[model samples]
Target: MIYSEKVMDHFQNPRNVGKIEDADGVGEVGNAKCGDIMKIYLKVDDNGIITDVKFNTYGCASAIATSSMATELIKGKSVDDALQLSNKAVVEALDGLPPVKVHCSVLAEEAVRAAVADYYQRKGIEKEIPGCSGNCSCCHLHDEHCGGDEE
Candidate 1:
């Protein structure tokens, strides 16, 4: 599979590649079929800005690269802005990935949403994460009102 230069760069030199011991929020997502897993850690300030972000990924180069790029894109951005992050944006930032590897980007996006959702839960804020399955460990909301994009 052909990989973009950006993808290769990120794979070789991933950014924010460790866990935050006291992270305010953490998210983990995976594709069982592909055996790819991504875990994201976030530290949010009192102002609702993401002060720090980190990730750990286990999978192909695309998975690692996407995770790295996702953290880089959201750092220092507000939680609201981070929620706007999509797999398409991650793919675009990486120049592109093999069609088969696109799912890695999707996992990266979901990981971000899951982390933000966890943040909300910790803060006692009632919020739903878009695109979340509501069945995942990252999302503690187990009600009929969970999951999917808001209309």
Candidate 2:
């Protein structure tokens, strides 16, 4: 399959790779349909802005690209603005993905939301992530990530 130049660039040299031991939030997700997994780490400042972001993904090129692109999009942005990010945006940021690989972009978006939810969970705040629940096409694409077991 033909990949976009941006996709190849991000896949070959993904940004924000690795974990943050004291991160304010961390999120991981997978796509069972293709065994693609993604992990996102975030450092949110007291003002509720994302001071830093990173990701580690084990999957196809699109999966890795989406993860990299997701981190770049959210870093330095407010948590609320980050939540506004969408899978479609992720795909578009990567210059688009193949029809079969669109789910990877969805996974990227979920990784961010899941990590933010984790931050809320850690803070003892009960939060709800819209477009994250129910039987949406992207929601159906999830594989749990907090456990760290790759599938």
Best by TM-score: 1
What is the per-residue lDDT of model 1 for residues 42-151, given as tens digits with 9 covering 90 to 100? 99999999999999998899999999999999999999899999999999999999988887888888899888988888899998678785235322221222335333
Write one digit per residue (lDDT tens) for candidate 2, span 1-151.
8999999999999888888989998887764444677878889998889998888788888888899999999999988888889999999888889898887888888888888877777778777887664122233444343234534
* Predicted structure 1, TM vs. truth: 0.87
The lDDT values for all models are 0.86, 0.81
What TM-score would each prediction reach against the true structure? 0.87, 0.86
Worst 10 residues of 2 by lDDT: 134-143
How much lDDT does candidate 1 score? 0.86
In model 2, pairs of residues that clash are none
Look at candidate 1 and tell me the lDDT of residue 10: 98
Best by lDDT: 1
